[model samples]
Target chain A: MSLTIAIPKGRLGTQAIEMLKSAGVGESIDEKSRKLVFKDENRNLNFILLKNSDVITYVENGIADMGISGKDMIMENSADIYERYKMNIGRCKMSVAGIKGKRVFNDDTIIKVATKFPETAKKYFNGKGQKIKIIKLNGSIELAPILGLSDVIVDIVETGNTLKANGLEVFEDMYNISAMIISNKISYKFKRKEIKEIIELIRKEDTE
Target chain B: MNFLNIEDEMKYFQKMFLLRKEIENYLYEEGYLNIEPSIFEGYDEFTGINSRINRKSTVKLLDNNSEILILAPDITTGIVNKFLPRWEYGKKLKIFYYGKTYKHNGIGIKENREMGVEIIGEKNQNTDQYILSTAKQIISRYSNDFLLEIGNSKFLKGIMQSCSFNKEEYDNVMNLLYSKNRQDLKDYLSNLPFKNAMSTLLNILDLEGTFDEIKEQVEGLYLNELMQQGVEELSKIDNYMKNITDKVTYDLSMVSELSYYDGIIFRGYIKGSNKEIIKGGRYDSFTEQYGYKIPAIGFTVELDELIKVLDKEEQR
Candidate 1:
């Protein structure tokens, strides 16, 4: 059976494509092109270009056998798919960020948090036994802390420049974020050999 | 998705009814009598014995006495509750049931139609073969291309025993296994004291292949008395399942939280279906919770999920 994999669009996906090129897995992807799906008959692999967040949804529903996503995305969804392999491509950190010289996590005050990952934020606060009201945001989460819309932001921190530019600083680092390969529970079973071979091929390319 | 006309709804019912009738006829000819399970059961009675039941998902109601009642979330447990309370020794019964089980997922409450069969007072290879073959036949009828993935509960329990993990660690390890997250498991195991068990656990977690490979790999594991018992249970029926290697996958890492299952556990999945269409296991230990110990094994075909699959294929 031909294996289908979901990859995020843009830079992270471009990196994945370069890696796949070396591994001899997927076809050449054109991010700018209107085409969303690329099928490599030569390699017997199919690739679906999707929004980074939608990658998990595809794999979770078995629309695709496997998907490439970030740990932040994995931590956000409650979908019961397997986190099969860690690619470590887009390495970052999920942090609790607030305005400089301000305390948010220390006190018992019911703090409001703003993030794209409400589920992930809820789980993090739940682990700390802290009460938090999450204000879900789409973009420019840094503005929430500055605009008094939220006490802090629970989001992925790449270079800390975004927070610095917005006059905010990370209060606590929650998790180390990176790209990962996730598979549907049933798909993992039926396509374990093929999946393993693909992961191994990618690993070989990584080492080289 | 819910805007189907009356004609479409009627046709849906007609197809479902015909499919169920075919299965019921097969059950009757196989000496399995049909039985209807009650819609409501005492919540406290069942929960006191089994903690695995999801409290939030169960539809609970307060009765006139202020006691809690739950809409039957599952059929097997209800059947066991009915039989085990007043069960007699050497009393053999083969029964089949069709019922709607209610579960409240995060989105909304969904009613699932399930057809299941149970055999009580049986504890031998012949009984296992009968149950396995019957399950295979029923699942194959729904989808020609299907796989019945099998695993032994004792296998995982034995591994846990050998590892000597405390409750917290065991739960953490189970979470890792559930997600197939190798990185965290490796990191967690590196700090643990049991070096031997860690390696064995990692190998089992990665175990995946045809039936024979699974058997061979399981045998290669470091086996204690408990682990040996698990292997013995699986080895008995491993030979008969060899021919259908393409349609089966067995591994030790397959873990289910269904605490009632004490032996073989399996799930059936068909092509084009992301979710399992059938699930079952041997629950002799679950029956013991009612204070009567009788060997029993059974499986349920999720009629609603099956209907969805059939409906999709028809459309294509």
Candidate 2:
């Protein structure tokens, strides 16, 4: 019996494939091909390339037994999945950044924020007992504060270079994030041994 | 109301009503009593161990005395409270319930219709077997392919107690397991305050298979007395299930909500659905707190999810 694993197609895709190869997947996935699904019969595994955000949807519904995606996406989407491994790739931080700081928030004045992660931002602010309005943006979040559309933007920051280039600075750090391997709740039970073996192999390759 | 279409919505409600009738027939044939508790309840009445509702999740009204009256968040708690004191010793009560439970979700206050039966005043393998078989029978009516996953709350509690973890570490570990974060679980386990408690129990979390395979794996581990009892109970339940069906499986990381579901915990899933269509367990955790001291085992079929499964199959 072969187990299906979902890997996202983006910055972490190549690194994820490399990690899988090192973990003994036994077949090279043709990334350039027009196929979204690949089968490695020798290793008893099937791989599917999906959008970074859709990885959770596929895995959560059991279409794929396991998935590889960033912790930020997982937390933001609030996807119900088991984070199996950290993968140690695509490392970043979910933070609140703005143009060189203005004390972020000391008093509640209905601060308007912009980001792709509205739920996460709401949760963070709610935890601090501060109320804010979230103006969700798909991309170019840093420009939200610069163009006077919002007070600050909550997003993932890898290096200070992008924030500095856009004249913004990290104000508050929410949580550390990296690519994590996730599994469906039912799949974890039915495919325990097979999933564990692959996780073990990937664990070994991750440390190496 | 913002679902796909009116026809699909009507069909879903129609199927649920049909299923409810089926449930009523089965309960009546099995000599079960049907009861309906009040939809209006005091919020304090539902607070305790095994209480899945809290102040936050209740839609409440302020009375003239400034006391809050909550819309019923659960049906089982009310039924047990109303019947437990009047029950005669040595006699079992099989009761059935069909009602709408009101509770708050992240977005809004929602109501869900629950059709279920509770077997009270008995705490034995026979009762467990009866509940299991009945649950399987009802769920199989909606979906041809379904799986039953069983776990023991006492087993998990026993293992955690033996580990001697502080309350913070214990909550963190359970949350990780609840979220199925294996890597974080490993990271958290690696730095445990007690080294001896780490190795064996950590391995058990990943142990899942047929009851026989899992029994062999668990038997070889070093278990405390409480843990041993839990394992024995599960094995007995496993043996009882042999004559029924082969869809039974075991999982160690299956911890129930804190203060609820003391003994065996199980959930039923259809092959295609993301959520479990049926959830059943042995939870007498509230009886003692209510001063009744009666044991109870029951299951609820989430009609919405079941209808969704049937809808998907019909569309396909």
Q: Largest TM-score belongs to which candidate?
A: 1
What is the DockQ of the complex in model 2?
0.54
Inter-residue clash pairs, candidate 1: none
Candidate 1 chain A lDDT trough over 10 residues, lowest sum: A199-208
Candidate 2 lDDT (Cα, 0 to 1)? 0.80
Candidate 1: tens digits of C-alpha lDDT, residues B206-314:
5655656766676666777776777777777677777544587777677775568888888898888888888988888887766678999998999888888998988
**Residue pairs whose backbone atoms clash in candidate 2:** B50-B259
Number of colliding residue pairs in each model: 0, 1
Q: Sort candidate 2 into its docking category.
A: medium
Provide per-model DockQ scores. 0.82, 0.54
For all predicted structures, in order, the TM-scores are: 0.94, 0.84
Q: Give the DockQ of candidate 1.
A: 0.82
Model 2 alpha-carbon miss at residue B66, Å: 4.7
